[model samples]
Target: WDLVCDSQSLTSVAKFVFMAGMMVGGILGGHLSDRFGRRFMLRWCYLQVAIVGTCAALAPTFLVYCSLRFLSGIAAMNLITNTIMLIAEWATHRFQAMGITLGMCTSGIAFMTLAGLAFAIRDWHILQLVVSVPHFVIFLTSSWLLESARWLIINNKPEEGLKELRKAAHRSGMKNARDTLTLEILQSTMKKELEAAQKKKPPCELLHMPNICKRISLLSFTRFANFMAYFGLNLNVQHLGNNVFLLQTLFGAVILLANCVVPWALKYMKHRASQMLLMFLLAICLLAIVLVLQEVQMLREVLATLGLGASSLANTLAFAHGNEVIPTIIRARAMRINATFANTAGALAPLMIILSVYSPPLPWIIYGVFPFISGFAFLLLPETRNKPLLDTIQDEKNERKDSREPKQEGPSMKVTQF
Candidate 1:
């Protein structure tokens, strides 16, 4: 479109503006979700994206198309951020990461399959329209959805939250809803809240605390690294073979299969161990890809594609884990922070591809470094296995310090019981 309108020079700016919109959207959506409710904001997110994306499909000029794309990015982030929040709320403690990751992977699977369909139809705009249609359906679901239980409980709405939980239990046919709900603890918490009413401060006033700020800042950077590495690998996967598109398609298929299996593994395996182990495996596969890329021209592409799937596992985990760490008020912000970094990495990936013309697999070398660094980051994070997500920075800070130590079962760690 830029070329068609003889304004191709604006493409770079347009592209960044499109991404910048998401950055702004991430921050704003986070704030909005905190101020409003997750369900309400999620509906707005879908409405914004569906309407904007449709306009983008019918845009008459390059500038107009770029504007619509920018709008779509903002709206799209809202939808994804809400979805992350929803999946986290909906999942059992044991399978939180797996549930969220598998669900996010479903997005990748959907987009790839859409591309496959677009290949057959051969109309880019129509394919886009097809993709945006799902958002409208999601908007309907959002209408029927409940707000996050944690958020509801913290805000003094346990009765409302419990009602929602019973609805979910009935829908899922769980016989004992209240017995299993985190809301039971929250109900206990109300008495504590009354006792501590004068002593406790609000989030806005308390956010200025140095310890609180420092921990959240550290969390945000870690999230940034995870997203950067995740998207870096995804964007670089397109560079693996002589037929980049085919390689992407193949990995897309593997991603779908992996998504189907990953949830069950996460339920049993837990997040930290699965993430660390998978990153280690991804690093090994990448080293193999680098070695094979030097000599095996005929099959290196297929081998490299396999290695690409290894990195995707970490990407899936990060999306889920981001939601776990932050409280409901800041959940969207935290998720968006990760997404913002992914977008940055995605934007930089094209430049890496351009540089790779001078040197093939230079991008792969850089891409491979991501999972390795992520593996190291895994060492610092505590295991959230079977633990409910902390709803405040204070809760996280005291979680390990105050809790009783787990009983030793054997010489081996329990994290990899799966």
Candidate 2:
């Protein structure tokens, strides 16, 4: 209970344990969601978080607190993974970026809310309970949420898929849905996808295919670097300002603004380009923090805030791009693989902060370099802007082939050339 001067390291240990739990959750949740349905997993995770997170608040001892937190971490990761999948599945390509961005913006809102709550409530247990209780509402309402039609069809439940589609169409005021939307039409529409889904692929299939393996490997590394830099800077924020609450609010505000701008920015730039640009910007900011004289407190704080915002934007891009590029059949598994890398870096970020005691610039230097490397690595992956989501490995192959084929000259162009 006494996490004071002698036991301060226990705080870091608790964080590390929580990240470890998330890492495990990413793996377990991904497999389960892919095996079950996104709606079911989402509801279960909400309930788990509600119960486990509330218990964490009332823990009797530090050990009990950490254990509950670990369980809560698992639910939290599952919540994130499934929520993103659900959002991607529901939103059309035209609105997918905006949908995911809006979902992610809630984190920024939560951060600001936490800053306010932590300021208003001095008791840590009360703050924890306050946040945990809301999930109960979410879990109760989750029953009304529709299961993903894509998941239904791909999993060989065409009738259920058709029923869900009709419900959606009816909700959208499409009167013809009852007469027009039939099981045969649904099967014909997704015939290629349904056929491809028949062969169940393991997670290892990601590594076995050269193109997918390369993309996954690079994506995993990018996630690792982004999270390490992001969390390292976050953990080091205490040194940047005297008012933790004020600093936290500013951080959240900047992230919210950055996410709000992303949907607009994606309109002009490809996801790969935006990610590279942000990663480079993040690297420059981290490096600048080391170069800036410690006497100039204002400049350092500005750089740190900008760096955090850049990292947040880059993270959003990575998530959106991954979902877009990865085939639906193995998308959850690929996300799990990347999240494992991210949570691993997240676990070590606290340890990197510890290095600041021995050498001030050492942590920032390491953080600065990883993003710089990953920025270029992003160039290796294909651009997914304006592309339809691929449902199977064969779909990905066909897309790649289409992309590679040279465009034939139009009649107008031929006449002009003649």
- The sequence of per-residue lDDT tens digits that candidate 1 reaches over residues 51-70 is 88878888888778878888
Q: What TM-score would every model get versus the actual structure?
A: 0.69, 0.87
**lDDT score, candidate 2:** 0.86
Predicted structure 2: clash tally: 0
User: In candidate 2, which residue pairs get closer than 3 Å at backbone N, Cα or C atoms, i.e. clash?
Assistant: none
Q: Which pairs clash (backbone N, Cα, C closer than 3 Å) in model 1?
A: none
lDDT of 2 by residue, 275-335 (tens): 9999999999999989988888888888889999999989977887888888888776777
Error of 1 at 284 (Å): 5.3
